[model samples]
Target: MNEHPFAEFIKILGKGKKGSRPLTQDEAYRAMTMIMNDQVEPIQLGAFMMLMRVKEETPEELAGFVAAARESFHHDTQTISADLDWSSYAGKRRHLPWFLLASLLLAENGIRVFMHGAEGHTEGRIYTRNVLAILGINAATSIDQAARQLQENNFSYLSLEHICPKLYDMINLRPMMGLRSPVHTLVRLLNPFDAAYSIQGIFHPSYRQVHQKAALLLQQPHMAVLKGEGGETERNPDMDCLVQSVHYDELSEENWPAIFERRHIKPEELNPQQLAQLWRGEFSDEYAEATVIGTAAIALKLLGKADNQQQAEALAQSYWNARDKERFST
Candidate 1:
C-alpha cells in the first residue's frame, strides 16, 4: 500500500537527526491547514505535534502555521477590528489573574481588547475563563457575538473552545501525551481578529524570541511578548520585565524596572471572587494592584497612549482609579 498522505508529513518531521529538518514556510502552512481541516489521522496528528515540540518550531514555521490558522478563522473586518489581541493559555497558579483587571481598565479607557484562552487542559491552576465567569462576563460562542460584546463593552473574550476547537482539542492532548505540544506556543500567536496590536506571555524565557520573530514574520504592526507572571500576560510587579516587541515592522526590546523594592509573596490560595470585589472597590490588595497597574502600563505604551514607562504607569493608574466600581457588582 502507498504510504498514507499524513504519514509522509510525519516522516518529513521525524526522519532522523542529521536527515530531518524544519518545515519550510509553505510546508508548515499546508501541514497545519491539513490538521485544522481534520484531514490527518489522530495518531499521525499526535506524532506530528510531539515531534515539532521536541525539535522546537522555527519562526518561519510558526508564522506559516499562524497563517493557516488565521485563514481558517472567518473574521469579518467590517464588523470587528480589535485594537489589542491578548492570548491567555497559561493559567494562574500562584495568584488570581490581575491581567483581567488590566484588560478591563484598557477597555474602560476605550481600547478594544479581544482576549482568548483555553481552560481545563492542565490541572492545579485557575484560568481566565473561570475568573471571567465569576465576574459576570460570559465567553463569546462565536466571532459575531464577540464583536457585539466588544462594541458594547470595548472588551470581549473568545475561548479556544469556540474560536478554534480543533486547536483546543490539540491543546487538550497534553494530558494524554504527558507533555505540551506546539499548539500551546502557536495558539498564543493566533491573532484571531487581526488586531493591530497583540500581546503574548510565555512561561519560558527563551520562547520570547520565538514569539517576537514570529510576529514579525506574520507582519503584526505592534506586538509585545514578555515573561509574564505565571505566564498569562500578567506582569509580575515585583520583578523587572524585559519586553520584546515589534513596532511597525521593526523589532526592539526594553527593560522596565520592578515597581516594588521588595518582592511580595504570592497568595497562598487564589480567590477568584477577589477579582470582582476588587473591581467593585469592596476589596484591596497591594500586590494585585501593582500587577494590574504594571500590566496595563505595558499595554498602554504599546497602544501609544503614553510615551514612556513613567507616563504609561501614570496613565494606567488613572484608568484604574477611574474604573466603574459597580460594573461587575453583580
Candidate 2:
C-alpha cells in the first residue's frame, strides 16, 4: 500500500511528548505548501492543524509557513509598493477599531498601507471588513483590485478569503476545533505583498517574542508586534505598550509610556460611525484620540519618520490634527 504524502508531517507533530518535535523550516514549508495546494486530505489536515496547535508553532515553523503562504499568493507582490502591512484579525469587542483610523491617518500622509484580515469566524465582535464598509470603504475582492486601490487611495484591505481561500477555510474551522489553529498565528505573518514594514497585534503577550523572532527568521526588514487592545494593532493609550521589532536583521524592543494615567471606561455601545466622526473632528473622545495617535506613533517610529517615541507621538499628533476633516463625509 502506498503511504499518504501528508501523513509524515502529521506524524512529526503528533508523536508522544518525548518524541514529538516541531518541524524544520523546510518541512514546515513543504507541509504548508501541500495544505495550501489542497494536496492534503480533510482528515489529515485536521490532524496536522490540531497537532500544531497543541504543540504551538516555533519561530522557524512560522517563518516557513509564511514563506509557503506568500508563495501561494496569486499576484506579483513586487508590483505592489506598500510602505506598511497592517494585519487586523482579532475583532474588537471593548472598543471600536481605532486602529482603522490610525491606518487611515498614515495613508492620508502618503504612506501606502496594505491591510488584511478575516471576519465572521467569531460572533459578537466587530471586524475590520464590516467597519470599512460602514465607513464607505470597499474591501478589495482580488489582489488586482487591492493593488489598484493601493495606488489610488494609498490604503487597501484584502480579507483572508481573497488573500488565500485555503487558509481562510482553515481559519473558519476554529469553531469546530474548539480553539484557534496555528493558521491564526501564521496568517498574521503572511505579508503577501512583501511589504517592507509590517505591524502585528496580539492578544497574548507571549506571542510578541514569537512574532518578533519569526519576522527575524523571515528576514523582514521592519516589523513590530504589540499586545494591542482587543488583539488588534490599536494601542491601549492607558497602558504602556512594549513594542518588539526587527529592523535590518537586528532584533530590538522598546517600551512606550502610557498616554493616560487613568484607564478610560469602555463605551457601552460600539458605534462604527464614531470612527469617522472622530476623524472629522465632529466627535471628541480623549481615549479614542490617544489610541489613534499612539497606534500611529508606533508605526511612524517603525517607518523611520521619527528617531524616538516622543518625536513619533508628536508627528502622529500633527498628522491627526492636520487630517482632512471632511474626507469621510458623505
Top candidate on lDDT is 2
For model 2, give the 10-residue run with minimal summed lDDT: 72-81
- How well does each candidate superpose onto the true structure, as a TM-score? 0.97, 0.98
Error of 2 at 190 (Å): 0.8
TM-score, cand. 2:
0.98
lDDT agreement of model 1 with the native: 0.90
Alpha-carbon shift of residue 31 in model 1 (angstroms): 0.9
**Model 2 ranges off by over 4 Å:** none
Model 1, 71-161: lDDT tens per residue? Answer: 8876676668799999999998988899999999999989999999999889998988888888888889888899999999899998998
lDDT of each: 0.90, 0.93
